[model samples]
Target: MTTDAVFDSPAVPGVPLPAFVQTLLWAGWPMEFLERAQERYGDVFHIHTLLFGKEVVLAHPEDVKEVFTGDPDQLRAGEANQPLEPLVGPRSVLLLDGPEHLRQRRLLLPPFHGERMLKYAAVMRETTAEDLARWPRGAVFSLHPHMQRVTLDIILRTIFGAEDPRDLTDLRAALSKVLDRLGSAFSTIATIPPLRFHLGGFSPWAIFQREMAAADKLVYARIAKRRAEGPREDVLSLLLSATDEEGKPLTDPELRDELMTLLVAGHETTATMLCWAFDLILSHPAVRDRLVEEVTGAEDPQRLPYLDAVLKEVLRMRPVIPAVGRRLSAPLTLRGRHYPTGTLLVPSSYLVHHNPEVYPDPKVFRPERFLDRKSDPYTFFPFGGGVRRCLGMAFAQFEMKVVLAEVFGRVKLKKARPGPAKVTVRVFTFAPEKGVEVVLEG
Candidate 1:
């Protein structure tokens, strides 16, 4: 759609039409929602619609940061995220806004930081090592599902304790099933009304809610049993004892909501990131060789700087969450461009990461760019910026590095296909479209 043909109006200056927005919403549109705009117009052009109704797209880093920071409250990931709300409940920390968002960030950051996170390092390394051992040499395995399962287990173990690993398995399967449904669910259920009830059977939300309720039973049972005995050192134990401004314990529902939120939001995003990393590495022989050389250089494997760059590169090239959204609280001008309240300003990771000026050779897999390039803080925001930024950032990075180290250190992945293969993205998420088959040789 041309700039003039889009939903631009007198009331909202420089905006596009709703008719153009509806055109993009048709099923199975090639490329992601943002990429389609990038291809049609330059990186800075707009898309008036997506799965979540109407919005504008900004691929530039400065514009992107403006959405995240200057207008954090304006561009939010909200209840409109239908498929996610069920597992996390109505009041997950992920969906909170403004003062509530601040409070949750404070409460959530401590367990995921400094000394507390260090305790999980050994667990991460051990888990990665153990999981990679199961990958048969030359096997055509899908890393996306494997990474999800592993991260699910890691989150469960870190959040709960190792005492009941089976509980983690059940929760993983339950949450995965719900996510799979959402990823596949189309119709009025996905857009328009956001249905919570089904005519013949339980709705998607209902199935997920039942799973969440079952998972909560396990959480509360563990908490009750733990309290009956003594204090423990896990997040569940900490949250059980934590008070919210008022010196009262976190309720069962709140605890369960947070637990479920972390598992679903944290695991899925990171696992998608890792799968992208594998695809990026396997495709480029030189990058793969350097990563392997860096990772395998020590009696004890090292944190290879370039390998870290490779992961950063993958995240940049194929960011799982393509858009970081915020809604306007009070109307304002961003870079002298005015927008109305409730206007959805999307700072697209797809655009920002591929911004040629900020990231030279932005399309290529150059982990070196992150280390070598000069850029602003917002220029590399795989995790969203400002106060509402992801609390699990450190944990996700740690897990990604550990997993990458495990895979690259042990075996070399020879690409199974003859030509270059790219991951196919759906909505905001990206995954290896072919499951990334490769020959894993020792």
Candidate 2:
């Protein structure tokens, strides 16, 4: 899918900074950098950077629609996600394109089907309740780590079918180490060419390698045990029985990669987004009160429109991942303009969600907007869009509702620092800066 053919540079305005400088800004403070670029260059802009190359960022909903619905063959999302390959491995659905990607996606889709969430709901609710009961009452604490613990436990039990306490503890510790390191601020250095080297065990790169190896050992062990024991309800069991068109089951390496993909992608993103939910919900008393009222005595919080709307608004206001990208392998027309092969075309979810035209008073925390109208796919895609959209989207949202219900129904939380939310840049995600500090009000 590569060629030596040359094409002219994109016709859009570009970020007026050195490539390295732009790389640093984009890597370190992506939302801030993107907002500044949008303000300066309008909705359509380009930035040439060392890390991601020439990226054409599209923020207008129409433009976003074009990229989202564009041909996946020509718009190779897998290529655009190379930085993630080291973490999720090459066989990961996140790093596959065209036919390979489709096969893997189909195999992975069954476990995350909307109806399947009902089976997993019990695990989610139980995990959330148990985690919340341990939170320090009437004292300020970082809710992010606690949320992480809850979500990780849910992922372990519901997704991995991890029932053994010994295995759970080992897997949890290993996986947490890997994610904590990968999601840390300094993790960005490992992505840069000049800065990405190992200086023995203490080096960031070396330490990540060690943690990943530890996690992989536990994951592979689980896969083997599941293979021997036969099918159960969890995602791993379903995947173990899954096969490609040729009727071949996924190999050990493939299973390892996909499991790692689910853990790394699902764990932190869901936890961090949950943190944003509390940050937003507590900041807006009316919204919080209405949400609590809706979830308090409800038989199923998932069916509560207001609770669903609250999560929807939280995703809209603070998307965990700022953008989804596709590297063009053939010339493609977007927003009435054509981008050549090798151009990384990105649909900025943060920018589109914040667009005043699409969302009036976009900065306001208003779940009622969703209650009034259905969200347009292109305008509100926190889980991304098109065929390559996140497969775990439904599961994550369902899990969020269960956890939120447990929180709002059982306890009242007030933000320790009541103000606008501050975003911290992990390597690839947007998280609460101070972990969304909060206190339980009796």
Candidate 3:
């Protein structure tokens, strides 16, 4: 089908809301809006919103397949991620398109793959053990912040390779402040085009800029120090020494942007997913019992089938990123309907995971479903699909498995309530609303 075919095909139906109202709905409750849109308009529909101009959402497995397997030149994931520019910076791989994005991806892929990632497994285990040891037993606490701290430490030591305790401490504080600010309601408003204006240092945008500057200083210092100290095993050293096809090493700014992208993307999503996994496992006693038995007895905890299945089920049920978007650079046909260029196509992971036809009893948590059958990329892509899929998928999975194994084997945790934990959007990721309250048992 061609662009001409779009005229014959009816416009994709969606909620008819004014731009501002649509933005309000999106900013307030994105998942709810998507769910409602899916129920009312079917799998393929259009939504006109300020964020992406004109957008199309594809929820069914078939439509999502076309999207994932579409021509890379025609579907630009980087352009679709423009809203993240202010946070990850313009030079980040998440924002760059075409050849530059490919170059950066190639360079950044090695450390997160194969034996290199195996080296980080020890770091993940050690950090989780240390952090969990500090938790007060028999006291009610939110596991979210604890998971965040552990994951942050893992990223710092394994990826950034901050050797100095002082540097690590400083960087942690700055990053925490920046992330907290980003998660605020005012920061969400600051992302809007008209509100992006700076009103001196007091404005939310200005404050964010200041925090970014502080973070940049520490990151640059670390980069410079790593450069002078020669090669090391961490991801930073790998990136510094890496070259493009022309054998050109990454520049300081390029390194900084890539590092920041990894720092944010690497830890935040994993931490949030970890919180969800902990809550899910604790809430389901049978699953918890099975997991503990599997983890404790296994020689290689990472190889435990049930633990892996449990993690997969958690991701399927509660994908940290609800949808992965792509803006069409060329007219395309999706779900037998032609769409014009400049249309934003989003593959809703949330909708796809909960599709009753594909997953029977979708609301119920069942890890055994994974063992029964393997999921195709188009059907079960929590890290996304196609060429732009998340580079840290392996590393994140490994970290999750290792951390869960270590924690479950050592500490006994109990849920504070019998009900499921509430979900909330914390910045870009879905997080537990009350932070997954639990008590460490004696």
Write down the lDDT of every candidate, Cα atoms only.
0.66, 0.85, 0.84
lDDT by residue (1-442, candidate 3, tens digit) is 4433332356677777887787677767777887898898888776666655666777889888888888877898999888777778888999877888899889888888866777887788888988987998888898888888988888898988976789779989998787766567776777766787788768778877888899999999999999999888799999998998999988999999998899878888888899999988998999999999989856676778899899999999999998888888888776557778877788988889989988899889999999768888987989998888999999899999999999899889998887677777776777777788999888
lDDT of 2 by residue, 8-86 (tens): 3345777868888987887667778989999998888887667567788888888888877878998899999888876
Question: Once model 1 is optimally superposed onto the true structure by TM-score, how far is the C-alpha of residue 266 displaced, in angstroms?
Answer: 1.0
Report the CA-based lDDT of candidate 1 relative to the real structure. Answer: 0.66
Q: How good is model 1 by TM-score? A: 0.87
How large is the C-alpha RMSD of every model relative to the true structure? 3.8, 2.4, 2.4
- TM-score, every prediction: 0.87, 0.94, 0.94
Name the lDDT value of residue 433 in candidate 3.
77
Pairs in clash, predicted candidate 3: none
Off-target runs (Cα >4 Å) in candidate 3 are: 1-10, 19-30, 48-54
Worst 10 residues of 2 by lDDT: 1-10
Clashing pairs in model 2, backbone N/Cα/C closer than 3 A: none
lDDT, candidate 3, residue 96?
76
The CA lDDT at 156 in model 3 is: 90
Candidate 2's C-alpha runs over 4 A off are 1-10, 27-29, 49-51, 191-202
Best-matching candidate per lDDT: 2
